[model samples]
Target: MKPVLLFLVSTAWTLTGAQYYYQGLMDYLENRLLAIEDRMQFWHEQSHRYHTELKDFKKLTTEAMDALSKEHSLLFKDLEGASVRVDRVEREMDYVESQTSPRACANKADKVVEQGAWGLEESRGEEEEEKDWEEVQSKVSDCVEILSGIRSVKILKRVGSPKGMWTRDPRSSKVYVFNGTSGDSIYQFNSVRDFSSSLGVSSSREIRLPSEFSGTGSSVYNGYLYYIQQEDETDVQVVRFDLMTGMVTDIAMFPVESHALVYSLNPETVADLAADNEGLWLLYAASDNEPNIHLAKMDPDTLDIEQIWDTRCPRENAEAAFVVCGTVYVVYNTRLASRSRVQCLFDVNDMIVSEEAPLLYFPRRYGAHASLKYNPEEKQLYGWDDGYQIIYRLTMKRKLLV
Candidate 1:
């Protein structure tokens, strides 16, 4: 019985020890699983934060690229504008240089016999030329008057091109309108009242010219129309058309320097034809190299160049010019539009000195004038500014001679 009890005791001890060891092993495995779960949760949170930061960075970069593109486009436009301005300036400079060179002046002197029969030296003997000039100057001082200022402005019907001309004949009540710089059509009105009426050319007569005129320098005197026609590349033909017959009465071909325009500011006007109290005058530049304006006295009947005079008025910055009596008033302005002013003057009789000439400024109207036609009969200036037809009433005073 003692032996059997010993055996049972030993077996019980061994079973209890095996159960404790199994429990310890299970605890160790559960602790290890819990640690692994905590590590996985920490890693998941870190990955989510990194993704959000990357998305925000991508959005900021896109916005920056869009802003830079807009700036680049604006910069390109500004550069283009600057380039255009620079090109214009360069062209003007080249034109000026070609006109003022010594070679051009020499060529002009060799070709032209400036003093014709009408010149002071040829009109009288060389010995009496000084006396003749003084006498003519005295007569001019007595009869001719200086322009004081513009008294009134009447904006008549706004017609045709921004560069055109309209004038009433000094002898008759007839009004003539030459539309664009180059056209074969001319409109005529019976009277100034008819032109001013709002009928809008319904009462006007459209007379087609035989040939197309080249420039805006055209005029009507008595019953005839005188205009410049381009005859080939370097020559201009002055055509005289009879209003009554509607036929070309005479044509005179005159040589010009080049295709360069007479007025730098007004590129459309190659020459300026003006009628004053002294008769029909042709205002032109001798050559592209000559900066001064030249005046020629033309006989309305013969289409002959009677005399030529160097006006000494610069062609640079000149927009339009008109002759009052025997004096030429050159109106000047900037390329960028400004108040027009009579900056230069030339008198055939040498009655008025340029230094003492009145400072004449046109009332600031619509842009610069494309044409200024003086009517000695009404004592007014018919002007084309932009597209408006303006009439300037004059106030004259006895010229202050020096």
Candidate 2:
């Protein structure tokens, strides 16, 4: 009985120790759970504060945007008001200027009358030029009639300038060619008022040119003189003369079709023509063809069939086009209206295209078969209008600057 009671007491002691250990572990776990809940509550408070601040920030940003929009609207209104005031001031100034000036319109009218008187003088000049043309035409007609038998007079390039009026030989290279009559008689520009003094024509032996080879068309380059030659044959052809050897060489044989006359100041198209310095260039067309730009280049000396270059001619640009100082000046006309379409400046070397500038005004109606010349010495461009036979000496100006 005593040994059994001792064994029961030992078992009771072991069960009490296990119960104590389990109770301590449960108390520790409950404390840890409370600490975790406290940390979670703190985080929730912080998160709520951040969300409220974010909402307030968004509201402020929207308000600021609204204010900025209003400010922009006000600025735009101010600018509009300023522009209106400026326009009003300009109008008032213009009115005052007109009132104070010697009526510019009246002055312009007087100038037109004065110009009318000048036109009378020009009319007389034209009369004289007409006589000269008759003589030229007679000679040209003679040549053409003779040339028709040779190759059929198909193409013609008329080369002449106002300077021809003062030439000593009317039948000289640029205007006339005849049978080498007498040396002095053959060189016939002496018909002009100042022929004797100009050529110093003394005797028939002084042969400046052969009588058989004088015409109104002349080209000089590379230390040689070139003139148009039509032999006594039925074909009217153009030929080049060697001033050194006194020999004639044939050049172009134009197409044998009836086409409108086209003229060009581009040395390239003329083949014999040349632009000595950087200056204005011109291209003239006389026929009624769908306008487009055309370009050509040739060696002035050899004239070895000049190759074509790039051109600014629009699809409807006039049938003729030319360049000056590397800038392209074109006459664009289709039916009746024509305007000067000068293109941007281009480099002759690199062929680089740059900014473009329109001249004077919107393109204006102009005469076809017009002649343009630039005197670098005068910095002026001279044009001859064949329609009414007028001369226009134009200088570059800041146009339409009202």
Candidate 3:
């Protein structure tokens, strides 16, 4: 019985020792887990703070970039303004110089206009001489023969402002002239015969164009007059005028930056507007460069620029333009005072000027500020002279290579 009691006491001591060791181990493990949790929480807080900072940093960088971009654009605009100012100053200087030292042709012409009977006779003699020379030249040259055959009969007197667009209705042979800047006067003819009759007695109508259409020139297609005008200070718009309905429609609006050539000046606005069977054409020069004519084909409906010709017109002072059978004929004035003009033909497909020598003349009676149109039906050319205030018709004496 003693041995049994001793063994029981020993076993009880061992169980108490094991319980104390297990309790101690559980407390240590809990302390370690708490420490690990605290470390993880610290790391997570650091990560979140870094993420916030990174986002703020990115936002700041973008804002900075945008601000810099804005500054750059403003600087560029200021520079462009400076360049334009310089150009204007240069042109003014040139004009002043020209006035001081007149050209020989201008001086001679001015002398005749200023002098009385002597001047008149001199001018008349010069004109007669030029006419005789032209006659002889026409007989000599094939191109001149065709150009010479063009008879410019005075059809109308004092149509409108010198700066205007002229076109004829193919269906009715009615002549229509649109003066965009000068009170929007649209001179419309009722019949071919009415063109010669006295203004009040003539069977014709004069109406104000739409208030918004501020065009320099225009083309007629499918019985609609299509023109490009200032949409706003910076935008140019293509619009259509329906003669039958007298309704004006906005076809498209493009920023002036699109062409960088549509001038704000009265004389050098859009040089000309023309249309053929294929599409509409816009004749513009890049930034007051009157000599370089840029021809572009525009979509009639969408007003999208479909194609820009690679050909650069090799002429200065191109006042009137017309497209026939894919050949663009431009009326260029070599001398503003004299009736000296050159008609240059540019082929759109070839992008080169035709080998045909320039028709060294236009209607002698018509003045510098004139608009040209080709009558496909009659196979003739018509011009409205602003200086002379007359409408003239031209027909080729021989078949043109075009």
Candidate 4:
């Protein structure tokens, strides 16, 4: 009976130990499964975040590439423009070099001193002739006589509607007549000589402007047309027109006060534009004040006005103006039957008018509506009369203002 009791107690203890071991195994298994599930969820969230970041990076890359393309195109265009300017400068320098060559036999030795060796009789005759010429010049205060007269008259047949300022290109000698109403209405001489001869020989080419483009004062530089455009009477801006591409660009804007103060009364006013060796010039003529007219010289590239001067115009209205050899010549209506209109020269250095008046004056046919233009290449002045259909080629007779 003692042996039986001991065996039974031992079996009971062993069974209890086995039950605790099984319980601990089950708890370990459950904890490991929960940890594996949490890890899988963390991996899924990380993948989604990486995908979102990749999408944002791709979008930003595309935008940056687009900006770079635009920058490259602009840089290329600028380089091309620089090349064109350099070529033009080279051509100008070559022309100057060619023109500066000295002429042969231009300077002559004094014949009076060498006459004894050659022959005294021949020298005496030449001296008497020179004295006679000198006497005539002295009587006139050494006034240099310039032959002034109309060289030719031609009717500009191709001009559809000539209403505003006219100018001649210094390089090409092509005449451009502006029509403010339409760009298609702009007239250009196919051959200036043919058009000047009234032959109607060669047809003109039309420069079509955009519908929104409008201007009054016009000039050409390096094959580009420049003009002042007035949006309103008080709003003015400078525009550049490309002759080859028919592209119009706004370069600069004038002060509102400049427009408002000028041409206070006249609603339909004209602006004068002229160019010479000295650069570009602009004339603001119509004003109610004492010194009504204002003249300005503009920098070609910057559009900055370098000089400004005031003039009390002697005539009723200023039609055309040009700067040449450091002098400003103005054409205006004189309103006299004997002399309907006149061209007056003003010394730019001395902006002073002599009491004698009209430093150099010449009469013109009274065209009720006429315009004047000067061609530095031809050294000729062109006068166009819309009323009589007459365009006059005039040569100036100039004398020093005594």
Q: What TM-score does each of the candidates earn? A: 0.66, 0.33, 0.53, 0.51
Per-residue lDDT value at 140 in model 1: 52
Candidate 2 residues 1-402, lDDT tens each?
Answer: 999999999999999999999999999999999999999999999999999999999999999999999999999999999979977875565455333311101111111121212122234467775664444333221111000001111111222232221111111322121221112122333232333234333322232554333222243333344443344332223345554465554464422111222332221122113232432122222232623333344444444444444444443433233334443444444445344433323334321233323222111223442333323322323233322212222333110100
- lDDT per residue (tens digit) for residues 27-46 in model 1: 98888888898888888888
In candidate 1, which residue ranges exceed 4 Å CA deviation?
1-143, 399-402
Put down candidate 4 lDDT per residue, 308-398, tens digits, no spaces.
7664453345544555544565555434322333344454544223322332333333353444555656666554444233445544444
Choose 2 or 4, whichever is better by lDDT. Answer: 4
TM-score of 1: 0.66
Q: Sort by lDDT, best first: what order?
A: 1, 3, 4, 2
lDDT of each residue in 1-402, candidate 3, tens digit only: 999999999999999999999999999999999999999999999999999999999999999999999999999999999979976875565345333321111112221121212222244577775764444334222221123223435545565566565667665667776653434557777654566564532346775567544545666776777766664556666777787888886567643343344322235454356765455777665454444567778876666788776345644555566775455766666454435344555555432234434343543454565466665555555565663335445443322211
Ten-residue region with minimum lDDT total, candidate 1 = 103-112
The per-model lDDT (C-alpha) reads: 0.78, 0.36, 0.57, 0.53
Model 3 residue runs over 4 Å out of place are 1-155, 200-203, 255-268, 288-291, 387-402
CA lDDT of 352 in candidate 4?
26
What's the residue-level lDDT of 8 in candidate 2? 98
Which residue pairs collide, candidate 1?
99-289
lDDT of 1: 0.78
